[model samples]
Target: MGELNQIPLKTDVLIVGGGCTGVGIFRDLALHGVDCLLIDAKDFASQTSSASSKMLHGGIRYLESFDFALVKEALHEKNLWLKLAPNLCQELPFYLPVYWESKYPFLWMTKVALKTYDFLSGFQNSAHKILRAKETILKLPGIKKEGLKGAGVYYDAIVDDAKLTLECLYDSLLEPNANAFNYTKIDKVEAFGDSYKAELTNTLTGEKNSIIAKKVVFATGPFSDDLLMNLGFSWKNRLLPTKGSHLWIRKNSLDIPYPLVLQTFDGRIIFVIPQRDAILVGTTEIQAKGDFFDLKCSEEEIDYLLKNLQEFFPAAGVSRKDILSTFAGIRPLVKKEGGNAHNTSREHQVFRPGKNLYVIFGGKYTTFRVMGREISSEIVHGFGGTYNPGTTLQALRQPSVFPTFTPWELSEQAVLESLSHEKVRTFSDLIHRRMGLLSLSNWNHKKSFVDFFTGMLDDMSRYIIVNKAEITKFWP
Candidate 1:
């Protein structure tokens, strides 16, 4: 599937993005014995899929809007993944500190909301509790105590987002009818007698090929609006793109003993999560401009997050100096009339421009497994196959060689297995996306990635085009 020249001449379904949604559908359909080919312009989960806030929890704030269904579905999926792939997910107690001057300022009000979250999950979530200012201060040592009421504690989860998506893909390919590629792109798709003749180009190599598919799906997310129009479909723009950014600060930079829900002065919530070796903080919502893919966290966003973060933990003295890295991506919320980005719902919408073409957009990362079921069911039924929703409830048939969340020795054998088995076609694909190493700093190796692999250049060349200079470009 990595080789573009061996592209299948025909497929039952052709997917144009390798994010969680695409891979989720691939697995669902493959379980029904359907033939599918998934292609991405970059590595799997390299876009918005990898750029999530790394949590798999029900949006507690959405409860205010009475979005109980979304919360329940997401919480169920969150708990399911924790059971299905325990290695990639960790459940943690999140602390939402309440301020007397803030909305939901009282502990009783916050406690009620937290209880609602637990109730929605059929009590699957751990029990909720309320801690007084003294108890809260004991857990989060440097918290600002002025007008502090209490903290509402509830359960949620964290995950290696990119690794989960990649494993979904690897599991799908365990079926003979499922195939996928990383750097190949479907450039132009057109109707050809009840089907689509998709023109695919190797974005890195400029190698061209065409394949006919009975159904062509667009899991392009924010790129859906522009992609459909470019492909000659009379597609109306249905997306409200909002840019959200996150920062990875050095662990122990602040007194955050547990993940936090920071209620901002502007009436928005900012999450402060502690992951391995770092604290993951995010997320600002504003209208996106310019490019939609691989966005950089803006200075305004950084200033906003840091200012609010400092307000909650005044004694911690957190600043830009503690920041290790930053990332951003557009949220492809399905547009509603007169609705702005902040108020828009995180629900996905599907558009059928032709008889068999489908365009899917929106929804959060937590509910990706359920997002593709509507289409997968239809596609499977067309093939006279039974689609079982329980099929995906099983554990993933394949797991990535290297494990995240825990530290392990980086070996030459693991590196080669990643290139061959993980569908890694580029050095960036291997290090940044597939291996879940955002940078050399994330690697556990004492020496540089280049120094660790210098002896295996000859063996590594069989899978990826790596040299001393190229290796340095990734690490340095």
Candidate 2:
């Protein structure tokens, strides 16, 4: 829906893909006063970035693998964002309940883990505590009580993934000579002198144009493998495309009092997080089978999540009927020689196929800002600009119009303003990401979702095309 009237003839830097990594570098170079243009094949952060588990935290399970450095860096970033964007995300205490039959049974194992986790954060987190069996049951009333020995309480942040990435782009656009576009794709790329010539296309309108860029970076995330190879770059498959899916269940289905961490029989972990009006559950890891660009939650993954969830909370009686909606995404783990997707390191790799071309992929969502530092620094220095690493440490300047959480009003004035400024080109962009309506539930108590938008649809037509069918289907 984002149709650009004028295309750039040339730029100092051209970034392909507008996910976290892409936007991270975009903001970095923009802050250093370099001319940069970022373009995405679709809406920014609409793919794997939006489909994450939605938690910004150090991987607690990675400790078993002795990935201390990654865990430490992620913990620092986790706590930093909790300070940076208070409106976009919130910190919550995660309860990891341990049973007698568990591989790492309570008190000692959880005690040592929580101590190390707190130490990694330098005690910036809400202090981790090891609770006894009685205390665990008292705090988590709906948890499985059979053979429960104790629990480990730690802290992490829950974020609005799409909104966070969008805010990053907005912050970069506030800088001088900074630009970005969505629904724009690079159909082909060719070498040209010190710079490269990129053939860009408008995916929606089929418009075509070519531009010369001094430097090109592909921060395509999971789609990196397929994209670079298709664009005729000197590329090889470096990604292990793994599918992970989630289900949003009605809140009352589980009545969870706190966010939880559950370990499964298959050596994977499931996160049960409770958001306003819904219980967010998910993530079945398997080899990705279909199109990487578009992924849907498979029945097997859905059943897998519900089954593991039921095992942890047998009294809740959760099933497919309780699901409000479902979403799935792929994880672009850099393929290792012998390890599987679950065991691959959460670190990233930057590839330089040509003197001016860089390809980056395979990093945790929490470490995006740091992941692009090397590329941004090298690119900025190439343009004779002093890249200040501290610039990104500051809080983002632009925030989404709608507060991502619930208990917020939806107004015509706000929606119209967002449409004009937030790069919202479609109806779904406004309703899903900007407005933060993940499910079909009505926000206003006095009106149905459709009734609330009854007259608004006509006004919305002035900016983007819309009809009652779009509003009608959301309600009934």
- Residues 39-115, candidate 1: write the lDDT tens digits: 99888898899888899999998998898999999999999999998889999999999998888888889988999
Model 2 over residues 1-476: C-alpha lDDT tens digits? 12345778998899999999899888888888888899999888889998999999988999989898999999999999888888888999999989887778657988898889889888988898888889988898878899998899999989889989999899889886788888899988898988899999988778998999999999998888888889887788899888899988888888677899987867778899997777889788897755788688989988899999889889989998888888889888888999787888988899998898899988888999898777899987877778788888989888888877756776879888888889877777788888878543333342556676777887788777778887766555
Candidate 1 has which clashing residue pairs, if any? none
Assess each prediction's global lDDT (C-alpha) against the native. 0.86, 0.85
- Angstrom error of the Cα, residue 314, model 1: value is 1.1
The TM-score values for the models, in the order shown, are 0.97, 0.96
Q: Model 2, 189: alpha-carbon shift in Å?
A: 0.5
lDDT of 2 at 238: 91
RMSD of each: 1.7, 2.0
Off by over 4 Å in 2: 1-4, 443-447, 473-476
Q: How close is candidate 1 to the true structure, as a TM-score?
A: 0.97
True lDDT of residue 339, candidate 2: 77
